[model samples]
Target: MACLGFNPAKIRNQNLHYSKPSSKIVPSSKPIKIKPSPSQFSFKLHCLKSNSVSEAPLSPTEPQISEQEEEVDDPASELSFLDPEIDPESITEWELDFCSRPILDIRGKKVWELVVCDSTLSLQYTKFFPNNVINSITLNNAIASISDDLGVPLPEKIRYFRSQMQTIITKASKELGIKPIPSKRERYETVYQRHPGFQKGAKPFLTLDNPFPMDLPDNLFGEKWAFVQLPFSAVQEEVATLKRTFTFGASFDVELLGIEIDDKTLIPGLAVATSRAKPLAAWMNGLEVCSIEADTARGCLYLSVGISTRYIYATYKKTPTTTGEAEAWEAAKKACGGLHFLAIQEDLDSDDCVGFWLLLDLPPPPV
Candidate 1:
């Protein structure tokens, strides 16, 4: 654009050293692409209505505003105020900062949504509800109230449900005694002690082997396979990477190993939990549900370690202990205080693998 009140030829000649300004009008044979530099050009835009021109690169003597103009303030610079009604289920500032999950009453032939949100199971229900209140008692009542609706025992799962919801029948609403499911810390200690390989570490400072597993007296070729729990922080990345590594057709990965195994027969296998921040549901008899906070609970938490070739579910906490489970569970409950981190050793241990069998009975989800 030509600068107003200035000669176009003189300005073009001054700015473009390559182009010569001619008295005669001429068209170029080739298409010309010219991009003007900002600093080299100065222009004024005049408003036809106001008869005012805004000048670029104004001089010190130039006035910023005219006598006719009024100063205006930016509307965005001011803060906006709102008086929205607070949500009833929303957690107040005084309330504890905790997550909650929706109570899904699955006991009926058709699933029902409960009004109350169980904070313990809530973090898992974020996918379903935008906001929820955290109250376990309401959830407990919801499950207990549904017993009349339950006709036949549920397929494989509903029959196994017990912990907080275990009554001969669920119909009795009044004085519904909701038993406390074991806290995360207690469950881990109980499971760890009941595990034969981990029994040595139950009362520490004992002569537990370097691998820490105690082979059974009758069993030959004691299962060397074990597990080591990493801090819960790495659970997401490790689980994601594990899924990729264990994808079908993927080969043996030495990167996943806890220790180097020299023997060709001793190969390693691993299973990582996917929920890093997610609350895992600890199903009690398929009725009462307790929320197991990630990394805090021992529900299905297992990651394989050690020099074993065959994969076995023996080390898995889901299995009933070979011995003394009831006693360990009782003692662990007394010790729990809502916080725990397991003893760390470079070499973790696992049970000795025994001869296998085909699957018939599907294991129930632990509390």
Candidate 2:
């Protein structure tokens, strides 16, 4: 699922009102905004299945929104809570920037990236990291299945497959910022997400759940597609990227607060602690992986700076002193790509402690 990237700092202060009685209204010359309760409105989060034929799914060939004109303005718009492709009925403003941003035509492939920007800090990019992967075990399993189907020896195919995997790993490692290819070591680091306290030891995950090069009837080159698997260390692997990592038991909230550098001006900043009564979900790219009170999903550790950039850097100075401190600041690189900032928040009780790296994207200091 894509994150709702509408800048939290821009959310009207009056709209942040929650759990108060109606009589607390403060009259103003400006519009008196009343926040809607969840009981009163629903922002359609997809429909449940029904037996009715009218609720059937659309066929793949069915006419989808034309790429040229993604969203047609609904002439019947009530209040004009306007967005090019956003549903006006959505109580929460959805970021439909992708629908309007120019699509990239790369190698004739229409690459539509989920880009995010904090214009105040001049930081922009999407989290591009590997989540789904077919590892060595999965590759071996695929080879075994394919060889049996094709009446070939698995040994010869394994050698050929290993070579292919090595090639892919070499290229990908450069893009992944893994010093040596993970293909070489049974243990190599990639951005990851997991709870802090699990039984300490190597824990193998995603171990050959489904073999790639699936045995389809028309798939003639199953071996061609099932070339190799990248085996990750089946270890405790407790480390995870702070982009999606959060304090284990702390209930928290996140807000993108525009900071005040002077008496008159405010700059972009993000905060992820206090004023919120409960745990909050962390949004990275389009994925919703962490919650203040719970873990909804996992494996959303990516936070790359650009399309060409690899390696989402979230390593720290120390293992969190307390489990409540999910992130630690070991060192701060002066610059990342064109972005320059300090590790302004870390340790427990800081805004970044709850998983929002708000101050990390600040503009460079005047030289």
Model 2 lDDT per residue over 95-184, tens place: 111111111122222222122222121222221112233343433333234325423232210111122235443343334332221110
lDDT of 1 by residue, 154-222 (tens): 111121122233232222222443223221101122222222122232222112112222322221112
- List the lowest-lDDT window of 10 residues for candidate 2: 221-230
lDDT of 2 at 32: 19
- lDDT against the true structure, per candidate, is 0.20, 0.20
Clashes of 1: 9
* Model 1, residue pairs in steric clash: 100-122, 101-122, 160-285, 161-285, 161-286, 162-284, 162-285, 223-352, 226-350
* Residue 335's lDDT in candidate 1: 24
Question: Global CA lDDT of candidate 2, please?
Answer: 0.20
Please state the error at residue 327 of candidate 1 in Å.
Answer: 18
Off by over 4 Å in 1: 1-164, 168-224, 227-231, 239-367
Which 10-residue span in candidate 1 carries the lowest summed lDDT?
Answer: 1-10
